[model samples]
Target chain A: MANIAHTVHVGLGDRAYDILIGDRLLDDAGALLAERFPGRRYGIITDDNVAKAQLPRLLASLDAAGLQHSEIVLPAGESTKSWDLLGQAVEGILAARLERGDLIIALGGGVIGDLAGFASAIARRGMGFVQMPTSLLAQVDSSVGGKTGINSPHGKNLIGAFHQPKLVLADLSTLDTLSPRQFASGYAEVVKYGLIDDEAFFFWLEENQAEIFAGGPARGEAIARCCAHKARVVLEDETELGVRALLNLGHTFGHALEKDTGYSDRLLHGEGVAVGMVLAHGFSARQGLAPSQDTGRIVAHLKKAGLPTTLAEVPGTLGSTEALMAAIAQDKKVSRGALTFILTRGIGRAFIEKNVDPKAVSSFLDDMRG
Target chain B: MANIAHTVHVGLGDRAYDILIGDRLLDDAGALLAERFPGRRYGIITDDNVAKAQLPRLLASLDAAGLQHSEIVLPAGESTKSWDLLGQAVEGILAARLERGDLIIALGGGVIGDLAGFASAIARRGMGFVQMPTSLLAQVDSSVGGKTGINSPHGKNLIGAFHQPKLVLADLSTLDTLSPRQFASGYAEVVKYGLIDDEAFFFWLEENQAEIFAGGPARGEAIARCCAHKARVVLEDETELGVRALLNLGHTFGHALEKDTGYSDRLLHGEGVAVGMVLAHGFSARQGLAPSQDTGRIVAHLKKAGLPTTLAEVPGTLGSTEALMAAIAQDKKVSRGALTFILTRGIGRAFIEKNVDPKAVSSFLDDMRG
Candidate 1:
């Protein structure tokens, strides 16, 4: 394994697997997979975008190991998470005759990881999958959580399973292909790890933000820390019964904004999360639950990181407050006839608050829209 | 609670649930559901046949109990277990706006239980589900187990999940509407439990066959007994890591026969099982692993139960032995390039044989055809 920079093991009992992070882990991936998962062929699932950018490297690696492999390239976009595309992915694996013990490789960002992981979850009653997360957001967030799913017409990620991956390969080199906005979009989640119960990590990110942006060693360190933090939460609550809900700190509001913009380029998920975290802190401050200055401080850090921190910063006109409230109401995490949101007490301290008043949330959104 | 005769609790730790069996249980289901699942609306999924025969009764009861409910009526048959239908069932549940805490009721036979339960498993990352199994096959088998899914074009039940239900209401009254052939078909599974690990139960069924056919008290007793046996096996191995494989005593051969018959009504699932069980015994006796008379005895009993025990009984021109061998090789339980089957020493002495010879199996099928 060339340049094996970091290995984070998720201790999920029998379902546990390791996440490998390195500059050239992709080069050694075939050797790693051959060594760890002997005797099984591979089904490589990617999207059109990743097919052009990163597919050849992975294909070369697998071929070098003499591993049998099949490829399922879907149209690249958040929309690929629809039922039709899911069927194609599932049928693709079946057509390729991958057995239950075989592994499907999800070689892309969050959308590809979620869709491919979900297809693996149901194909042949369940198959193992490995995550080759190419996006910065995926490396630190979706890839490690075992939360594989697709968005519903009614809401985001409303249909899925909590199927863990057998392994995650975060090839740092893939980030070089990411657009500046896309890279900044992913940085929001790094900020989230620090915001949700890790003040020291937040301070570290603040000090090393420039270095991380410059692709320095701090970037790998920060991604590993984020994964490690998420791994701990997932271990405590794999099904999101409790502490794992903290991982959705900015997601509840973020998802609402995503729905408002129709899950398009106008609002990337991490960008929404960046703005959502700011709103969370702002709303908490308005309710006197968190320090007022904490919200401004979070906004400043996110702005410096090139993440959207305010509703107005989002491109295009957002939906009305009522529509945003309706979107929030439809969130999978929110129970029927009740408002539940991950509210913050201050920096590095987020908690799930059930039975939060809808009127209060609406007014906060109204104020934020200004 | 009227005429409530049997209650089997599957102790899967926190995922534990109850299987309630009783005459007129459908009448009491509304009250039972209301009392147990307060404030949770239900999305009822059933095939057109069951919807006609059982839906009105369930709806009346739910209305009586003031329970909010929605019905999704699919076409009646095995064809309903497809990707399109799975998407329809899942989207139906979502369109009905059944939240994660809400419930979906599978109100038909095995197909409905499997499809609705799978939809619940993935919808909103899993909503709680209840089984209102309306066929003898379902009441005795699928209702008790949490195995849920649809068939892949490659094989039956090749795509799905293991999401347990909140409750299983095996209302005995629903079985009255089943056709005689369908009833006898479901009886094959009842006989299977006896063959797997309960010689005494097998003997008891042999004695009470007339009573069970006449809809006497022995019918409920037999179902409850089968459920309890399955529950014990499930508790020992929920994900079929070990002991649970025993439950598929006749399934390996049965699945192949079903595939050959194109999963058509010409040879029902239980008919295939009946024939498969006879084959298992006959094959074991040929190898001197089981008493030769055991096969004769099982054939006699299944004949008396009106079940098809011989390959010749499966209507239509059969595939050649080689074709049958290929179908058997395609079994999900059989790993790549290896054969696994639930073999029997005698009645109630089935064991998993992981390395069965394909040549031997093919030759045995040739002899059985004669």
Candidate 2:
């Protein structure tokens, strides 16, 4: 039987778009985009890694569909998300002669998606853009949201805009190319949707863990499920002014850990999120909002899936608690100098807690240190 | 009797805002802002000129109203609209500890408004910003629209976003500090409203030229009338997809002249616009769209107002016609390499003309050279 695809619609009025999930979706990217943006030229932005692994497939598909395209390949890494590179990417798109009517295709992981999305957003006061996300992390998270920006020295994503893509093509087959560690890092986000507010999804993920890690039909199902949930939340609050804050389930603690690691490979974003989720659960228990058994169960699940569940599991020695606290204070979510965290009453139950006390966070960190 | 204020409300659905026009309105700035954004801190971005001449009155108002503010004063010039300075201004706002809920006040001419507005649009994924336009050019044009961006080597405003301001306070009193030459530069934009679609307003300005330039009630009335026209057009098309293009009446030729003059003091934006408007009228006659007498009348009125109305009147030699055409090609309005111009059918009868022949434009410049 042919592999069936699932379409998740992000309903944002005129800015609405669909996310197509299936194996080998890139083979159909040309047809998918041509229908929506007919006769428009394309500027494809990807990192060097993706260029080597996936560019040929995308190019062949476009060529077969009689579409014209130009490719801009930057170096592969987190460092690519900078103002200098952003300027270069924008200039590259212009150099390709892609006008406002043309489309920009982000054909790489999170970094390329962000840089290209931003370039598209500001070019001609916004041009259309499509996401051909290649990594597990991007396929499930970054590509679904319109959050596009470059990192500032002050913080990650401090300078950017909320520019949604015209369409998103998530090919699960691309996950086959990810390193085991990279794949596991993305799995962390899949686990996140369950931990956010879906008890049934969490139980399902636990039961189908092996099939998902083995890259079967279960993997695609997990990605589609996560996207559908995110799409619903985004449709309700596209700018993240209200209920969308719930989507930052492990982000507060996760961002601090990413900063502590200096945004290095020492802690991939998914890995940081995995540990952050555990810490959030632990902190909730300390505050008597959740049971200690709930925290233990979360750590056990993360460990079973080969994800780090504790700060000690991180490669480098995380300095003093004060250092982490300082990083958390600089989070984009921090408003009016108060710490805001996504705490939970139990598994699958998260809520935004604003004006959280620094002393309380400090005490919790100290206890976790043991 | 006290001068009654005029309010032009821009109807952009949820993004709607009001442009307030009055004399000595700065005295009520505190109470005005506090009511809409109560107890919110402000980050004021201005230039050295405004900081010295007008910052004191603004500071006094804020102090009297008990509002907190921090100022970032940049050197005054078009050069301040570069990426480096944009980064500095954004970083400055962050350093001031202003967050998402805080408001940024653009407290100078067009340069400050464009730079600060672009910064606020991207800072923390966008913070609210208010425009306090101090120049006639800013009050009548730039302050009304949310077109915020920085110039690139490619062309002016090639990089920007359509981020609207939350409020615009156009204090007629600020124009008192402008030099005669500076005031004339702003007068060019004032004349634009009449040329676009309001023959009655143009005739009114013609009849009251002396009083309008002499800082009388006519000046405030002219400014308010221009703002009201702009507000209505912006509400109808906030993103320049349709009628908004009508607002670029003299911009194509005006921008090319500004580029030819190196965007320097050799030709102020309004002065280039003054010449560009005449060129547009001359071009319109060349296309048989309007009578040559209309072009002559425009030149006569601009001359009476002390604004440059011909290319030869530019302070420096504007290079060859070919060079000028090159700059026009790089304009943001050029869609798919086709020239788009705002040519008039007659006074107060402007319309967008797409795919205009480059040969016709070249020949028009040749005839004007004589």
Candidate 3:
């Protein structure tokens, strides 16, 4: 009845840290943080939406622990992941009088985590940070990766650093406050872990879809399992030199969709990724790497989760296939003008395919759009 | 003569790189960089002054090596080390289409090196970079340490990342174009290497001052030795957690003087450091850590090098000892509101002194001013 928590450790020798998953983590944050960090001031960075819904609880926990803190609440949106806001967050942390030894608490979803994590990474060359991810997307993915960054006009997350968090507290209670749309958007990444490599987890998610979405024990287990998978991948390749690229399963296509929509609300990151995962499967089938049944299955699961699963389901005008290809070419993963994508052979069997032909991808996009 | 060059290897394991020092390194840069990095596009970030004097030679070298290159020339001055310029440098590098594997060549003094290095540090989570230090200050100090950053209104270098370069080319021929004042300013750091922990090096500097100023073999040897010392310190403490702080012997006091001068031409960074070194030694004498003769020897040496060794010699109005003390308090070296100073026992014997009494420092400043 203590609200059981699961711990996933990311092992990088001296830089190793743990992710704690459970319900009611906000109430326990004070004690957990104090026990882990010990006598450090906290600078809390959250988005306005999270501030309205979650900040008070987190602050109460910090106060209960007698931990002194200062908070900066940024606007809630992808646009908040800009250079100006990143500078503001860093300056705010400094103004709060946090030193190199102090810790920054990223208290919102991926935007806040990415922005705050980046600010922490570069402040005083580096500082300790804790990720209190309030969204499922962050809980299972971004918060665990240590890939903190801000968006550039040229591309998403093109400017930033790889600064890992000292701790991550994925409080399940916060997920309940998320709109069904937001929750499902994040579910795309949740399914991503399965599509990347874990067939059993994918099958488990397929069967427990109801419980997973109902905030039951399945939710916690799914999040924990996803984090564990991510941690293992990150530990093996901290700098994304090799196997880590597999983690970007839907991102190449996803980033293109997001860019096509100008990163507007009409196409949320996770929505783009949802559709992208389907496309990745579809493209894999088109490339003769997988059967069309795999693509159909992925699309079915995404649709069941109330997530966008195809180019047609995307909200805006996605322009020509050539334009989408152009956007894809701008992806950070593109190497020396060559396309690099994480294409799947089947469900839970994705592999990094480098120098994928642009013409082939463009023709596939044309087929998908048609 | 093959223009004898010396190489100092900074040992940071896989992050290790070499600093090559000699005359006319600009002529050899094409082959040197090609041999080291190989088949990578080079994005050159330089200041106007360097572009005017050294760009053609460097460009010719790249062309000779058949390497693709793009260059961004920023206005020359200390002021270029700002967040705005940092953004421009980053954007410029990206515009050049330099990817993660590409090399960014920082081809100017400290300002260019710091700005370009920082841009490389965050662009694409980091890109490869090489240092072609044209100024003497950079050749001996900033270029070797891998401490890259831009200045903030809050404080100088209060924000940045520790990004090592792949190679450093210290072209002594470029120093021939430096004004006497610039050369003397750079000599301060060279003298500092000896003052930090090498008495014999200090004695050798005293003997070879003329040769060093005249740009003889002694000049390359002195630069190479300083780089070697810095390389060792960085390898041991890449993040300034311990022994690396010793390298900031005069920086605490020097940063205050630079701030007092508003980081203008009135006090070149090295000039402030010249006077700051004297103050540090004087304060050590005041605290009975070293004999007065040690302070006198330091002042005499700086004076002989045409460097300012006293507060009265500073070109601008330094408000008050209290103001100077306040500036020192803002130093990045300040740990948790505690004053940290690198006070010396004598020439060639410096150590970290934490929580130094603020009042004691103020009175020492007052006495020095009087």
Candidate 4:
């Protein structure tokens, strides 16, 4: 079995925990969780989509490890992350009689991980949660970070908590079940690490796009490498207080697209982010902070991966340049009237620019259509 | 101005914070918050009751401190802590453009504190929050604990996060505006410290019940002392792992009473705890864990302080012994088949009992009615 490992410091003093990634880490979850949570109660939160395909293996692994557990399956999708649905999850936890020392395992993708982490955070004033990412998106991103929450009408992940998982088991085998679209969406987040801080990695992605997108051992290695980068950055800035904000390179533009599309399957997170990165690069170039060729390279690479690199390529998308800027203003990244945009001086060097003007961003969006 | 002080350690290694209490602490909330969170984006969440009585002075203080802030005044009461209301609070915070460094001040009692703290914990995956507690209950209890959440119809505080505040400013002078009932309710949590592990303090309260209930400098000192004790306990065990369970001494029975009373004004938290403590003492005596005289002292002290010490006195209350046990099972505290009841051997010495049979608890509750 292939082995991969990384660490995420939750910045919570003694309460901080780490995430461990590997091929068969599910077999090790019981031990890791038992170390942090010295109790008997264990509850697993997942969605039907995940439960049907992934829950049995998870249960079998836990059972083989001599750990007892119970499971609850939520309906699949973004709506499951609602405040109403969060209450249902909490009820399920309380109904299971979980205590402060027990653990809740999030056994699905981002939706389950976010909601379960949040439920664990609040269940008994803060208990323990384990993230068992069964999807590429969760494995590379959400599962490692302490950010967990549900969506509000005003925005996605509008209501949530910075609750780190006690342990993260990103079983690479789980990704095998992902559809092409799902796999590609996760690749978008993996590419994010390169865009944010690793120029060499960005170049590597450009060089190895075909191999990684085709899905194999090379893709797994790329996934692990990106997670390692993210984990290191997260440990240094757990609360997104400083360099961690760099991780939001494409998220500001991406969140708007997701919001505009009502977070539908038509515009998967990765697709939105793929297009978002192109826009970010274009905006950075328009501001004279990045080389113009950098924008073309990013778009070309995304297109080669069968991902949408421009807004027009995504069907049923809406928003004028003005609307997108207004949505960006609503982004958590913007402080005061100035937006903190992550721009690349070139492929390898990403920096935060707090002096970026919205009119420049709007103008860039206008140019993207041209 | 009277001086009141209590410190809380968040256990974030060197980043731990203390909650300082004083007569005019709220008068300089903006400055204290700024010291912890050096940003201008702040959103003050208050209720109509607090808005009318406290917002003007708070806003003046923020202005005098040269801080930037916006305010949202929600309707007062438990109803305001619902998901719908919390959704609106999130909208208000987003509307004000709160960022990770920005602070959201929970500027009222528990209801406002819970909702605002939850909103802060979830808004953009967590922002900074300062607890400016204006009520006796919040000052001595909820505000310092980092247990921020809202109540759902399924259960109380089932959805929340243990998001520690950046700072807590408990201005004791605000107690002057509390109704007598409100003041009495706050006193119940203060007595909890003594009942749980401080026999000397329990005896002290027994002797000084009159002075504490009178709402004076002595009362302020008692409140601070309780807060200090609680803070120290929380610092060592923030997540309620072990010793922290003792803090729930009277809460099991108290929660049942509050639920039975529909959490209305008919039974305030402390008053319910007063009755719960009496029942707990009676149950302990029956179990031969404590002397019967200890139960008498608990009831006598509560009576002298004008607090209820019997179930008959709890208005609108319902529950047979079985119902009470069922509610306890529903409590977020249960582990496995064992309930970790904080049973006192006597005043000041309490321990967890895993073998407290629910049948015995039911019988004890039935016997207590006699």
Candidate 5:
């Protein structure tokens, strides 16, 4: 009924899917779901945190569409993204007697989406999953990629399969429930779009920093735009074989920061990502590829949006570039000996570069202390 | 270079792969691997049992191909197909710095193939995997299908993904190490081809049982023929959408029997299937679909091959039809409200029937006690 029409294409041959974004999109869920999951049964996977807030609306929409559904709630956060939790969730789905054609609706943030997606990938030797993202971070990044997996004791997402979601539904209306800090944390990924590609969008965010930080329908639109950009890159390279690594622009550094805190609640993903992006830009400037003014502007924009923009600002964060390099090597983005670094020549344009010298990165780390 | 040129076709559109059968196929491992792997740093996964007996030849072949490889030897057995073992294997692969385009080689019997294939499927969001099946069961079944997974405390293959191998090498030479019992166990599946389809093959086995049971070059040819037949069926319908379910001729009963015995080595998979085939045929006869003589003849063949063909012979087996039915419901093969029963009109014409009355199945179970 609303003037809603937006799509994010994930490139994975026939396995590729679309992420549909717009206002009141949840209301139109039935038609879109019927197009993919024409089965009688639909299984919804959410977290306790999300089910309390958004389950009612999703159910009402599906009910209106005459879809029979069951729900399973998981614990919230990265802690629940374990193999044990994944197995438990799968057992719950199995209990519901979900057939091969049944849909696994991942209704929550990234953690819920990742776990549910991974579960569906293995359940019945691969089934269909739909991503219903409720957080800014999930809406922009995770909900689109087919990279599904759970964490192992050795590392995060160490155990998982490549399961693509049949569709992704990002209700702009869902972003209404957010603390200012959480909202800003998601904006970090929004800024990533510019640092990786699309300098124009980065410039647009630069101009609308105040309005974007205000958190409303406008901010939600901005988030959707960023997700659309991500979906395009993913569709081009579903497995991160080539250009998809660019999407991890700030993730290599971000993961290390998250790991340093043992992936605790001290720093949310986007907060770490914000800091990592600034540092990446700073490193680019040190390499004489990016202007210092551009790096300062990027840092200022993130700071103004209430996001952290420096390693110094992150307390209890590890400082060794060697440690960071080691972490980077462990990152999913590394291909052979070459590391795919998404860097900026300026705010409006991002490029993926390989064989980035770790010594130069170390030099950048040396300058950070001074 | 030996004449190794047989291929099994798993039908999944573009995701389909081939299983090649012959001798010294490992010599062309490079050319085959280059088509799929095409990169440096491959992960060679085998078990302690396989490593001691066969890993050298595989490594030597890789060396001849000028391929750089690393090896991870897991402890052998069904017990090792746990999350703890998978975690250790993934960590070992990561420690070796294996990347996205790099490959993982599953070299051993069914246990090693399933575990390693599953590991490759999840590691870094799915990498290339080569199936160098060293056991008869692995060659004809597990190696051809993309059904990669690990066993859980709850059930076998409760946790897994559909990650197909890039290429499969089912060298007949590997069968030389099988003990007579092991060789007989594999023969059970070989007999399955006749019970499910191809009456000619069943009659052929009837005439050639002595020669084939000798586990010589002729046995390899027979095994290859069976794999080729299965490959065509798999290629036509990779997901078991319809006709594929017929392949599970005795698996429903066999899997439950295995579960009853705690999936221990006491009852080899092939032996369990042998008894299961007899039970399934007996049930079919009770349903008036086939004559009792069919069941008698099938059971006689299994007994002649030294395979278990009766419930009383099952080691530590217990419980009622209801318990076996419950386990059947938990099977990845079950869909809707009924078990997918693979029953024959007679020898060599199996079909999958849905919604068969459970009470009839219960009565058939009661008859098995006699």
Candidate 6:
């Protein structure tokens, strides 16, 4: 009866869905899915890591309920988001003979969710999917926005679709399996919600930080709050056409840093974001757009959480300013050859700047290099 | 100006767009596009064949209007709708640095339209695109529906997205270059609109078939009529949850035969569809669901248009009933493992028939082989 802990609904008209967060939700997944999506066969798309740790629980649940399903396990890594793996995932879905009416269950973190969700988007000309995010970064960010895609050689997430999921199940207990670094990396995104436009939430997180990290009751509340904030922004601009760009507060810079590292362990996605968030704040202060103290406070907060707060902290030798600038120009946010970025006025007061100057960006990166 | 002929509006709320059918449209593409989508850069995706025949006209038009654009040309044929080509197209667009503010011009027949349109749908997580269909098959059928996709080894159009274009320009003069066989092959889809729900249009085609074939005034009228009919269906069921299934009246049977033929010249798509349409009627008649003579009438019309209306007329070996059944089961139209098909009661009276018996379909194919 207590399988559920908290729930957030994403109201996108007919495309709207619910997000459930709990400790033992995976144990009751069979009943949960059966009650929500009746008569639909499931195609569970997961990564190798999640398959060993999490797939069996979901499979056991479905089997116990006598619900029909198939599984597609791919290599687990940022590199898995490619045209080759995308084709394999889709071909597997087709080989399983899952109809458009059947549902695709994306059962992993951002990489698997983005790949599987994009596969579902194009398979049979778009199928419904549900996200079962096992990582904190995914549960708070990628899984909610319906922004599903794979990375191109040109850049990360340069090819994809805005395909929303029918539901999202975030099992709180699964967080136990993540390495300490992975957990901290995902926490960077949780911090992003507060930095985007919620000063009050940022203050609240500072207070509840230790408990959330310790797996206290505050952990569930923190995730729910992040989801609710994201749900509000997504509801306002589902397509990233306007207000939704706010969600990319640190992503534009984060992506360039990721590409600089060849998207490797030298910097995890969230680690890149932790540094990028600091850079974003520092750049805003340099532009006289915000108080310098706010940027300093953010650096301290992220540093205390065991997250990298500067480019110098990235293990590998950093790429040149020119190379990083080239990556930024190639990012999907460019408009009419002008750089578009999420620049902030202060903590929780981010805004979309469409006419960003590339020279300014290069200069900022140059100064940050020291 | 005599540059334009007819325009059909597909109203899907904010996603609505116009389908323009006319003579000299390709020559006028630059001006037309400049007027409709100002400030957006363009990426023209076409086939090598179309690049030779019609690409110059479009480029000259854009040049005259002072528009910026890039090109990506692939080999011509159904095989170009593979994952490899799709990757090439998306990479080309990204390499061209076409941002979300830009637009992709799908400038060729169904193969290019489906491939490029799909690329645009996924590139940068959904950019704008315009369809400039040259071949009759694309102009009359594929261009208007927003059902863009590529084929899988398993089946035709098994991978794709329902991404609507900003606008669709079916250049009538381009059809003049089509081989007579190719032209007739496209006429099958024109006849399909009439058969789907418009008995009067079917009769009209029967009466004016000669003039339409001769490229008379009736040709433009026929194409416009088909576009209008498709527009209505798409507006009502953009994602095809219900009535949209009617559009697949002959697709189930057609797809199996196409797969059997390796999607080659052994049986062009329209030829397979012609035979499929006849089989649908014949099967309906055998089941006491339709008038037997209607099947005969359809065969006569299709034959006169130089389309194959029987399996024996196909250029290569016909697979056994079991093989064809296997392909049919693998098609995207199957529902809950039951044979779901567009089975009609009579002409212009198609209905979605779920729970269709696969054994009956197998035996029916056995009878049709004779």
What is every candidate's C-alpha DockQ against the true complex, given to 2 decimals? 0.71, 0.68, 0.71, 0.55, 0.54, 0.92
Q: What docking class should model 4 receive?
A: medium
Which ranking of candidates, highest TM-score first? 6, 3, 2, 1, 5, 4
Candidate 1 per-residue C-alpha lDDT over A1-370 given as tens digits, one digit per residue, 9 for 90 to 100: 3676888999999999999999977778899999999999999999999999999999999999999999999998889999989989988998887888899999999999999999999987789999999999999999997899998888899899999999999999999999999999999999999999999999999899999999999999999999999999999999998889898988989999998888999999999999999988888888899998888889899989888898998899888999998888888877777888889999998889888899999998888778
Over A160-244, each residue of candidate 4 has an lDDT whose tens digit, in order, gives 7777777777877788789988888888888888877787888888878878766656776786787677768877888777888
Candidate 3 achieves a global lDDT of 0.89
lDDT preference between candidates 1 and 5, better one: 1
RMSD in Å for model 6: 1.2
lDDT of 2 by residue, A1-370 (tens): 2133788999888989999998888888877777778889999999999999999999998988899999999999878888889888888876666778889999999889999999898877789899999999999999998999987777778888999999999988888999988888888888888888998999998899999999888988899999998998898888888778888888888888888888889998899999999998889888999988988888888888889998888887887899888777877888778888999998899888997899999988888777
lDDT of 1 by residue, B1-370 (tens): 4568999999999999999989988888899999998998999999999888888889999999999999999998888888899889988987887788899999999988999999999998888999999999998898887899988777788889988999998889888898999999999999999999999999999999999988999999999999999999999999776889888888889988988888889888899999999998888888789998888999999999899988888899999998888778777787776888888999989988888899888888888888
Q: Write the per-residue lDDT of candidate 2 for residues B198-256, one digit (tens) a residue.
A: 99989999999999899998998899999998888888888898899998888899888
Docking class of 3: medium
Q: 3 or 4: which has the higher TM-score?
A: 3
Model 3: what TM-score?
0.98
lDDT scores of the candidates, listed in order: 0.90, 0.88, 0.89, 0.79, 0.79, 0.90
lDDT of 1 at A10: 97
What TM-score quantifies how close candidate 1 is to the native fold?
Answer: 0.95
* lDDT string, candidate 5, B251-318, tens digits: 88888888778888888889888988888888888888988898888988888888999888886647
Candidate 5: misplaced stretches above 4 Å?
Answer: A1-39, A56-70, A152-155, A317-319, B2-18, B23-39, B60-67
Candidate 6 stretches with Cα past 4 Å from truth are: none
Please write out the lDDT profile of model 3 over residues A81-191, one tens digit for every residue: 888898889888767768889999999999999999999998877899999999999998999989999888888998999999998999999999999999999999999
